[model samples]
Target: MTTTFGATSTTDEVLQGVDLSGKRVLVTGVSAGLGVETARTLAAHGAKVVGAARDLAKAERATSEARAGAANGGSLELIELDLASLKSVRACADALVADGRPFDVVIANAGVMRTPFGHTEDGFETQFGTNHLGHFVFVNRIASLIAPGGRLVNVSSAGHRYSDVDLDDPNFERTPYEPMVSYGRSKTANILFAVEFDRRHKSRGVRATALHPGGIPTELARHMEPGEIERMLEQINAQAATEGQPPFQWKTVSQGSATSVWAAFVGQADEVGGRYCENCHVSSVTDGTIGIISEGVRRYALDPEHAKALWAKSEEMVGERF
Candidate 1:
């Protein structure tokens, strides 16, 4: 079904000839990077986009080019959202619900990366709290605003293979906090959130899925120590050399975000629902922590029982049941 799209495909390339004139979409993290590119391309193709960002001023500046280029009755509206804070997430969700606008898709695209040991405003671990729990409560609270036959696209990562959710210590109270470890837990949680969410909402034709936007150099790595990213690329390239695979080639923001829009609007609903996707297609369940870097969803990331457990844990942490 996605024969024409692959790792190198850009958002504009994937959405070519596809009309989105009447669609309304919600995209979080629109202050920069793939989020802005995703919103831009969608609006250029004629969808109304509600762009949410923790810093509205930053978002407005970033989206200036997008607003100027929009066509086909497309438009963009900025909204304030801070995923790390439940109060902010809830306030945003309540505002959207009050507006009574139905979204064709809700893209929980905002997240933090390997931050140093810290806690959110709610005292939860920064990575897990911001990347997973924050979106968890935010999406669940606004679940009804998604129109039937809609989609929820969680921007996850291949980093999930680094670790699985530690339900007992989601906040890393006992476990030693390494940035990637926490990031992995949070990313894995993203996939599992989609797994359970799809099961709960697919019957109503609203399907949930997660995707790994291939390795890209984005502001998401703002938390990394200086030169840490360069070290990572060297390591990845070294690994690829041993495996006879191509070395790392950074994806442009457009290419990285293609899979997100593809999964949200083009991929087959039944095939992608509750599944993890990458490279513009349904990812194979590799079922393990591979040695070298590569593509594939980890088996643990899609486990149904684990998904259910995470849902319970998230509800407990957020103090809200969906």
Candidate 2:
């Protein structure tokens, strides 16, 4: 039976009665925010979690706290990964491959939000590079290492409604870059990646899903300027007005991670695979009248043709085949 876990459901609440012993999970951006709660709660449920971060020192300290909160024989380890650097992404993937320990789930949870124009070390736009391409390459390299019936969860955002991927100029070579637009494109890519990945790998017993972890005030918003924040709030409030709904409310860290954790371990593979989830369930496709932080996936974000096209363009950009 499907349980309707809501916006306020905490990680522990969603995971109650779940036993993760012998489950191997990988979580990115575990140094802080939702990543920490995700890793910690899974570990608490007895999953062995490999927490990836750009800074080993910071991750070490963070995982120590995660370890303290773990129950049912849960534990966490640190791995170095700088998604803004393709070289680092490869290195981290290589390290995991060499370890040869198959994963039960891989959570592509690391991402940057609205940021000023900049390029990654690989010369892609910062948000797209780090959020989508980085995870793209990482997942391609490690796809074979996920155990049968395993999952790949990409932590996307509701912002995907803001824009769709412009395959011709994803890096803004021809168009002007707007921080939120770029972030939206990246998020859209995240969902498409999961869609295509599931199509290609489901026969091999690996399922892929993407999700919006709810609106939580976290470090991911550190890049937003005050004016940008104000503008975004205005947009959200305006959208809410038209929808005849209340303004959005921010979730706590544990609540923010509930959907992701549920996607990873709670639902049936066929039920969750290739779907964009929020509030711990598969979201319906809706028009943009929904508030910025509201629950729903956009039709464009789940288009099969778009998913396949993105897979091809991503292969060209990363210079690797999956």
Give the number of the best model, judged by TM-score. 1
Residue pairs in candidate 1 whose N, alpha carbon or C atoms collide under 3 angstroms: none
Each prediction's Cα RMSD?
1.3, 1.3
lDDT, candidate 2, 1-322, per-residue tens = 6566888999999999889999999999999899999999999999999999998898888678788887777788888999999999999999999989999999999999999999999999999999999999999899989988999999999989989999999999999999989999999999999999999999989999999998898999998877876777888888887778788777999999999999999877999999999998899998856456667899999999999999999999999988
lDDT tens per residue, model 1, 1-322: 4356889999998898889999999999999999999999999999999999999999999999998988999999899999889999999999898999899999999999999999999999999999999999889988998999999999999989889999999888899889999999999999999999999998999999999998888999998999988888888888888878888888999999999999989898998999999989999989643533577888999999999999999999889999
TM-score to true structure, per model = 0.97, 0.97
Candidate 2 residues lying further than 4 Å off, grouped into runs, are none
lDDT of each: 0.92, 0.92
Error of 1 at 175 (Å): 1.0
Q: Looking at model 2, report the run of 10 residues with the lowest lDDT sum.
A: 287-296
